[model samples]
Target: MTTTVVTHQPGIIAQSQVVVQVTERDWSTSLFGCFEDIGSCLCGWLCYPCFACQVATNAGEHCITPCCVPGAMIALRLKVRARLNIQGSLCNDCLVDTFCGPCSACQMHREINNSSNGHLQ
Candidate 1:
């Protein structure tokens, strides 16, 4: 766990302490369980225990690094401050409604097609 204090760099003083918290995930759990959990996924904003997270959060920005699928979701759970206006591309395996993001039906169709064409692993 880590905390950070940021000031205006000038004589103006503005400081906050960020606390990192950890939670557990179950890979076998259903999709709905992950996204709809308000406490863990929607309100957890101290997942990244580094200065970069503090900087980004202070600037009101979300990280856009290419992380693994599950890892990305986990990070989202950790760094989210409030509900996002997310639009596009939910995970293909899980059928969670990612706001304005990818539709669950379309994802299911793609999966069916891939499996039928022997393209799915």
Candidate 2:
């Protein structure tokens, strides 16, 4: 298993060590789990650009990137999957984006929100 050691300097001269285990796991929410979060679902349904921007921002990415670049959501999904060790592929990302872009964005947003306390990594 791969593990990461994170160090924190609490004081000017004192430091502490924290170990974080990196485990592979599936996504917290399915692609069709948009309705699970009413807020996310409504936001995604009513205003897709705003929802996409929120997802991108939550993932520590530029909010405007998804707007300016095509397929940016797919790239964000891939990055999040890689960071969290989620099993998926570029083809899957493409399909999700193509078929249910809004729902996919909402799902990714919820997953990221649930996984890291609203932080990306």
RMSD of each: 19.2, 10.8
Best by TM-score: 2
Which candidate has the highest lDDT of all? Answer: 2
Cα displacement (Å) at residue 48, model 2: 0.3
Q: Name every residue pair that clashes in candidate 2.
A: none
* Displacement of the residue 43 alpha carbon in candidate 2, Å: 0.3
lDDT of 2 by residue, 1-121 (tens): 9997868655657559999977778888888886689999999989999989999999999989899998899999898898878888899989999899998898888888888889787
Worst 10 residues of 2 by lDDT: 6-15
* CA lDDT, candidate 1, residue 110: 30
Quick one: RMSD of model 2? 10.8
TM-score of each: 0.18, 0.78
